[model samples]
Target: MRIAVPLPGTMWAFDVISIIQIFDDDSVMYGSSDRPVIDFIANASSKALDHGMSIATTALRDYHEKPDLIIIPGFANPHEIATDRRTRDAKARLFTADPADALAIRDWLVASHREGVEIAAMCTGMFALAWTGLLDGVECTTHLPFLDDLAAQFPKALVQKDRLLTHNAKQRIWTSAGGSICLDLCIALLAEHAGQSLATAEANMLMMHYPRSVATRRSDGAPSVLPRPSRQSDEIIALTRRVREHLSYDWTLTTLAQTSHSSTRSFQRRFSEVMGVPPSTWLLTERLNAAKELLELTDLPMQQIALRTGLRNADSLRKHFSAAFGVSPSRYRQDFLRTELRPTENV
Candidate 1:
């Protein structure tokens, strides 16, 4: 079965292209696996759109021939933007606005649905799908921050926010959560056609781990590791959870041992044996992870990041961040922003 992805105006270049690359770059999949090819189509500026992006594709001679699946990639919907009243207001409007691009897309998608195509929308793209009126009287979801907006705008639709992915079997439509869930959506899609084996292999290749399905509550509040042998170490798990909750607090070995209700020697041995790392090393790694996430996901200053991750100061943030990522925090943020899909006022 074939798939189609429409490149509408204001589309996040990264969101659209990541899905494209997943299917188009079969070389990344297993050597013997069968993968379906996806078509990318757009109406205007065949060569260009938001973020100065373009793709090469052959114009389909027919619109009546709907592909088996239509994957609507997400658009960038940043929580913050430059601090100008007009720009901020415009950015706000464009995020939820039903622009001409979305209206046109709605019309086309409604028709494709009649042809029995399974439709999937990622992140804010769900807003466009909702505009089609097809989501009315159906259970759906979108980015966590915009769940209220989606519900208010489409009162007829049952918008459930807790889910990372929502699939209406009757409608054959799938909606995935925002940001990184695109990877989750892609992995699930590939698993649908290819087998779990191929999807797992692709996840490993991409440095991502696939969930059981879109419906499963992911145990991904933190980075994951091999499963513990039994639930007896629930106390240690509880202690670790507390550490994440209070990452910035000054934590010492004595305090950690007391928290775990064990002697310093016993606590260090148990933590190392059960969690695969000593408490000190694990704490350092967690701090480094927190700093890295802040750098990649936010525009927060180094001092703020240091304070948040318990690094204590900007210098420490730089020293540890650079050691872990091989780049300073500013350089790392610049490299991330270059590829990140910041929603466009026009898109």
Candidate 2:
């Protein structure tokens, strides 16, 4: 599993290198020391640093072999970084990346992806990935501060502001929310490329619990939070987006197949092929996911929440919610209720 990191401009965070090191170490431990070769390929042979960080790597033109995966690290936001003695000279390179470099890197990524190289972007690195136009119509997320900018700039990209991770299995692109969560994304990518056992070992070594969404936790403690897009035709992807936006709507296999302009049998086969679940199962999962969000973010009554999420009533919602999350709707809401939002008892 050869890994590549592309360097276009400054403000390169350490995510790319950290991920490489972990994978490289695991390969060595598993007696494949020379496997998973790491390469830092750039448009230029050497890019000058802005005083805060430095890296030495080869030029893309000089590297002949294509990598199995490409990981782009988040570029540091200037406002987020304090201007201390080390980084006082660092330039603000967030959205204002060098156009020529960005274009060169974007072109390389587009070409590489066509040849089946999986791409993963961390935090604001998503900005660069978004530049490739592959993220258009694909679900993604970024650092909280830049989520709006990412959506505004790439109007076609489906930005999930609340999602900690998003994967377009069809395109083989993975994106994550910003900050240390990047490490969690790295472990996920690691689990996919390497084995899950190694990924679990690495997470334990790092003393981090694998990042799992409450709605998809497995008993084994492995991560199951990779909310994936349909890995099939555009019709399927479009159908998925529609279902998510209208979770409250009463939907059936017939209705869903008609919406996608396919017959019921064909739609079921295609949807299940890409999503690993039938249309009905997918719809139920989406509804449950929406319910969890409401439980965390709103104080709406259980009946209203159920109605809004297409779960019929409070009893149905409670049954499904507990089955998925191992807790009742009321209990789930209690766990996420803010201190200020909680009702005060009489003194």
Structural similarity to truth (TM-score) of each candidate? 0.55, 0.55
Cα-based lDDT for every prediction: 0.67, 0.68
Q: Residue 322 deviation, candidate 2, in Å?
A: 21
Candidate whose lDDT is highest: 2
Predicted candidate 2, C-alpha RMSD: 19.7
- Residue 157 deviation, candidate 2, in Å? 0.2
- Give the clashing pairs for model 1: 10-347
| Weakest lDDT window of 10 consecutive positions for candidate 1 | 80-89
